[model samples]
Target chain A: GAGVSQSPSNKVTEKGKDVELRCDPISGHTALYWYRQSLGQGLEFLIYFQGNSAPDKSGLPSDRFSAERTGGSVSTLTIQRTQQEDSAVYLCASSLARWDTEAFFGQGTRLTVV
Target chain B: AQRVTQPEKLLSVFKGAPVELKCNYSYSGSPELFWYVQYSRQRLQLLLRHISRESIKGFTADLNKGETSFHLKKPFAQEEDSAMYYCALSKAAGNKLTFGGGTRVLVKP
Candidate 1:
């Protein structure tokens, strides 16, 4: 793909239900980032993946929020027992290198937890 | 911990008027600052970085280490420039970026 791709574009789930958001980063990009944005709020860093391993997981809101990347390409953010506060736009971005580069972002997944 | 702060939630400017979007940060080490913008129905994209010192689409931001500010500025605002702007800070070589609350700019005709 020419740019980062994310799916499903929008999801509406009941509270306590689990949800999964997927992100496919740009080809050959080694750095992937996951961020959560509340309504009219700044992005909250969730995790950062350097290839298949995540060097930073300190930003995850809780233990129920976990993410994984496979083959250093596709990444999935999973939230177990979702809460109303979990409703937000989940954005994914990829960069060629860790530094001195711009990150390309996906359209983002709008998650609605009822 | 590094943090970015954007004070304005909304700003309106007439076309051709000067515009400034404020940003501040807190970091102990040297920080790299960036501005990202998102237009209506579009994905977030990079506007400019402090290190590059390059102006894009008539917008520029200067890093002020003394005040820990990196406000985005434009001499003449355009309707096309209406968008959501975010300020971000990163470590000298860090992969993760700390983003500030975005400011929604509306350039009226």
Candidate 2:
């Protein structure tokens, strides 16, 4: 892809259900990131992946939130037992490398839990 | 832990007026700072980085280590410049990027 791509631009899920958000980073990019954008709270760092391995998962809000990247390319963010507060725009970004490089963002997936 | 803060939630200015968005960060080690902007219905894009010491679209940000602040400023605000601005910090080595609560700028004609 020319830029980072996120699937299901909009997702609506019921409480207690699990949802999966996908991200396809640019080709040959070695680093990927996930973030949540909610009202007032701003953009919260969720996870960081360096070549299919996530070294930084401290930003995951709770046990219900988990993510994984495969082939150092596509990534998935899964949320279990979704709550109303979980509704937010999930953003994915990719960079050439981890060290101080510019990150390119996707259109973002707006997940709404009702 | 590293954290970024944008004190203003909204900034309103008329066309040709000067606009400044304040950003502050809390980090123990050296950090790289960047400014990102998002226009309506568009994805977020990098505006400038402190390391570059360059201006973009008439906007520039200076990283002050003394105050731990990276403030974005533009001498003349344009209607097209109305967008949500975010300040981000990246630590040395391979570390996650932290973003501050964005500031929404509204440039009126």
RMSD of each: 1.4, 1.3
lDDT of 1 by residue, B49-97 (tens): 9889999999999998999999999999999999999998878666578
Candidate 1 docking DockQ: 0.68
Q: For candidate 1, what is the DockQ-based docking class?
A: medium
Question: Lowest summed-lDDT stretch of 10 residues in model 1 chain A?
Answer: A49-58
How many angstroms is residue A15 displaced in model 1 relative to the true structure, after the best TM-score fit? Answer: 1.9
Candidate DockQ scores, in order:
0.68, 0.74
lDDT measured at residue B106 in model 2 versus the true structure, 0 to 100: 98
Please, what are the lDDT tens digits per residue for candidate 2 over residues B6-108?
A: 9999999999999999999999999999999889899999999988999999998998999999999999999999999999999887756889999999999
Model 1, A1-114: lDDT tens per residue?
989999999999999999999999999999889999888787889999886554589889999999988888899999999999999999999987656678889999999999
Deviating ranges (above 4 Å) for candidate 1 = A52-54
lDDT of residue A56 for candidate 2? 86
